[model samples]
Target: MSVAAVLEKDYFTDYSILLDPYEYFDAMRAIGPVCEMPATGALLVTGFKEAVEVLRNNVDFSSINSTVGAGVPLPFEPNGSDISEQLEQHRDFYVGGDLVVTFDDGRHRALRSIANKLFTPSRLKQNQEYIHQLAKTMVQQAVMQGGCDLVNDIATPFVTLVIADLLGVPAEDREKFREVIDNAPPPGNLDQSDAPTENSPLVFMGTYFFQYLMDRKSSPKADVLTELAQATYPDGSEADLLDMVKLATFMFGAGQDTSAKLLSNAMKYIVDIPGLQAQLRADPKLIGNFLEEVLRLEGSTKATTRVARKDTQIGERKVSAGTRVLVALAAANRDPMRWPKPNTFILNRPKIAEHVAFGRGVHTCVGAPLARTEVRIILEHFLAATREIGLCESNHGSANARKFNYEASFIIRGLSELFITLAAN
Candidate 1:
């Protein structure tokens, strides 16, 4: 397709693209590895090798200035390509705004250090038993009900509670926060609105965590909040109070929704594939690979935006300085050159681990370990707790209810609602 033709197609606002995107991805990739949409001043990258080149080379493509405020470019771009200056400029636009994903300065490394300390491999492994028990409890509740909306009753609530535990929220406040978390809309849900503000979900999180962090600072306790409050940079400087608040708030909003979507996507396939649950129950070892296949097939994030710091080339396409680049991770994950039968979901695919579902390079999802552990435990517990899982005809209002609605956003991809019936084992 021509540049003008691609520009005419609104990748960000079109709702239909959310429901089905592989065709669009294939078409864009067919044009070239990198196709510049003149209207948006962005290049859509759908090739695997091209994406890795951009993601790993942060100097050429600066994520810092790409999404300065509310994800769009600021009025005045930072003068030079200094990572610190870019971050400082971003912070000026949005106060209390030093997100680990967007910030590319000393503070970014410091926040990342804190995250590594908090969610280590051993730490996540230790939490597995607790997560399994929690999943089992939720599954038992759903099994008793005969049928339930898997997205709401199981995946959504499970992720919220897990995040609450991870954040070290007091037991008293968790129940109240569960309601707040469940009702909050996930990313892409607000894309339809014009200049969508933080809305209810963000406002609730920002207000609640602000006070929570203050309490943690004044009265230290044995929890994640206390740890965050006392975290320091490599230079031994204490983390700023506002930065901590922003990190905490961002974690809840960004972390919960993605984990829930991962779970929901995996379940949709398991219930659709005949005897898959039974096979999984017989051999629990396959659970890990199964989860990998699901992630590869349906990653929660479809595309993330970046901008060229200086003129660069992705494949043969020449990208100019300050040009926005949309890295389509989902499309890259399905690159035919990288994987044979790229569209199929094969649990035992040898190269499954190579997929970029959690993204690549510096901006990879920090909550990845937690997300994996959460989904693995849920699947393990669900298989052990249920004899059979099937779609609920009454809930869908038809016997042939294969079609489903998805989140209406170009960025995040997930089912809006998933109703299922389960028989107890």
Candidate 2:
């Protein structure tokens, strides 16, 4: 299909975008790294080098929600048929001056400080056993079925439960959270705002957890949930219930889906390439190397957007203070300049950690270490158990490289579903 044709269907809607990502992405990359979007009048930064440059330049660009307006464009289609109403509601967090993503300097540092307590090495260590168990147990469930869709069968359950546990979602609500992903109307035909806002089952989950947060303010529990409950404002004030709700929602919202797809995509390719799978199974030692390779090639969160803090040069283009720049992490991870034969997936790519799948700047993903650890462990146990994993005859095709479903949402990249039939030894 021609570029114009793909842009309308895939780029305009969430569901369609996931249907065949590589084709669309390759076409966009061919247009040059920093091309302007005809519809939104914002830069669609698609090349690997430009994306890294934009992300590394924290002084000139920022993640604050304030930048999300017309000045900064979302990666996918605009669904806010009623833009004014969307802005009004968005104003709540936007007015906070800066949240984790959109703020800069002192403000960004302050927000990150409150966020960091949860990520303390000790707190993370406390969760190691839980991560290991969750990975094994979830993997077993998929194995039980003989054949499985790794993304939905194993990945979603594992990541979603982990987030749910962290947020103190009652075990009862766990299924409900998964249901949102299972049933949320993907943005194909649905108008975007109509895309379920955070207020559905998620709203209740956030509110229920916020109360627990309030209860632990004075008497802090050792858990991260309690720490988040008590996270303070940039000033000396403590976070309120609404603040807790945002934090609560952002916890799962920021990651679960993408984490699921990261595993699925890696699993999909590794299993198909029996040689690579065999190599990993024999030397489980290379699980870290394999995960890094997967990350560089098939990143979870494809792109992140930031608005220019002031009229400035991003490599060359003069962006106005409010101009939004979309940094394509998926594209950058494969930039030929940064990696050898950028398009091919080499399991032993050197210094693989350099890939910015977790991003950079003050807003760099706080969950990077934990996420890496989880993906690593998941692959280790998985590769160790299986002899050779591959696509069932039914699922075989070159479709993966040419077409793949990533989360169509403007915010993240992940597969909607990954189907694979595994042969366990």
Candidate 3:
């Protein structure tokens, strides 16, 4: 299809494109590395090089709109060649504008430093046993049931409790956290008309974390929460209570949601791809490479948004200041210029880490290491406990005409539910 034909459709809201965006991305890349979406006037970065350029250059591109994207209108009108002052003045108008993902430069650096405490090597090492035990128990239960809904039955609860333990959340509050997050719709859902302005699960999580941190500050305890509560900025000054709250809650919500979605995506590929499960089973080491391939092909985060802080160029395309830029991570990962036969999933693909599945530059997913460790451990347990794994024929139909449902969200790519039948080893 011609680029004009592709641009004719609003890739953000169009339901058909949301279901399977690969074809749409392919069409966009055919035009150029960066093409303007006439519908929203957002520049779509479909080429890997262009995506890297935008993601790495925080000087010219601001992440103020990272969470909301182009779907939401800027609070203030763009003036002259720079809207930096305007963005600051109206920052609160942007949805999730207070989030760490939306912060830039010094603010981002300071907040990220405090949040980094939760993912320290020693902290994750401490949580490793809990992750393994949970995965083993969950896999064993699925084996006994013969079939399971992978999203709810396994991934959601598993990742939630893991994060709870890592964050030092009280045992009594873990189940409530799980229930609130599980019931909340994933971000960027197309069906959510008020997505741009609506309060997310982060709001609720933030409330709890706010109270936890406040209490920790007043009554110090020997826990991660106390550490976070007292964490100082790089300047050795105390961080704001609200900023810490935002970082903590954002971590809890983003960490679990993205990780859970990733697990479901991995399982979908494992059962759908012929001989994949057996191959991973034979050589457990291959599971790491297999997971990378899955992430490259269908990572949980499909795309991320950035706004140009100043007039700039992404490849050959000129972007005006304040223009919204949609860095298509999924599309860029599959760019033929970077990956040979980008659409096909090749195990042990060379330089697999090069893919921007977890993003690039400073804003890379903070919980990435923990995510990789937990998902890999769970997959290992499931594969070890099961002799065979296949999709539920009744729910997904025959192999020839398989059917699956994906979350109706532009930003997130994940299965709403995955039904799988397993044979215990």
Residue 10 in candidate 3 has what lDDT?
A: 84
lDDT of 3 by residue, 1-425 (tens): 56677778987788888878988999988878888788887888999998998889988888998777766667778987887878878888888889999999899999888777778788788888999999999999999999799998999999998888878788899898888877876677677634633446778878899999999999988677888899899999998888888888888888897889889999988988899899999999998888888899999899999988788889977888888889999999999999998999899999998999999988989898888889999999999999899999899899899888988788889888899998998
| Model 2 pairs in collision | 18-405, 48-332, 63-101, 63-102, 64-102, 407-414
Query: For this target, which candidate reaches the highest TM-score against the unseen true structure?
Result: 3
| Ten contiguous residues minimizing lDDT sum, candidate 1 | 65-74
Candidate 1 Cα outliers beyond 4 Å, as residue runs: 1-7, 65-74, 77-97, 175-185, 189-200, 394-401
Candidate 2 positional error at 154, Å: 1.5
In model 3, state the lDDT of residue 72. 69
Candidate 3 weakest lDDT stretch, 10 residues: 192-201
Candidate scoring better on TM-score of 1 and 3: 3
Model 1 lDDT per residue over 174-201, tens place: 6676677566554444464333223455
Point to the candidate with the largest lDDT.
3
Candidate 2 C-alpha lDDT tens digits along 1-425: 56676445424344555554555666676766677666556677767667777877877665654223323343333232223233223445442222355556675576677776666677667777888888887666666666677777788778787767655566886787678656653322224522212334445456666666777776676666676766777687876556556666666655575567678878877866648888887788887877788888877766677666556766567676656666767777876667788878887888888888888656778777667667778887677656656665554555454334555555455666667665667
How many residue pairs collide in each prediction?
A: 0, 6, 0
Which residue ranges in model 2 land beyond 4 Å of their true spot? 1-10, 14-17, 65-99, 185-202, 218-220, 233-241, 395-406
Give the TM-scores of the predictions, in the order they appear: 0.90, 0.82, 0.97
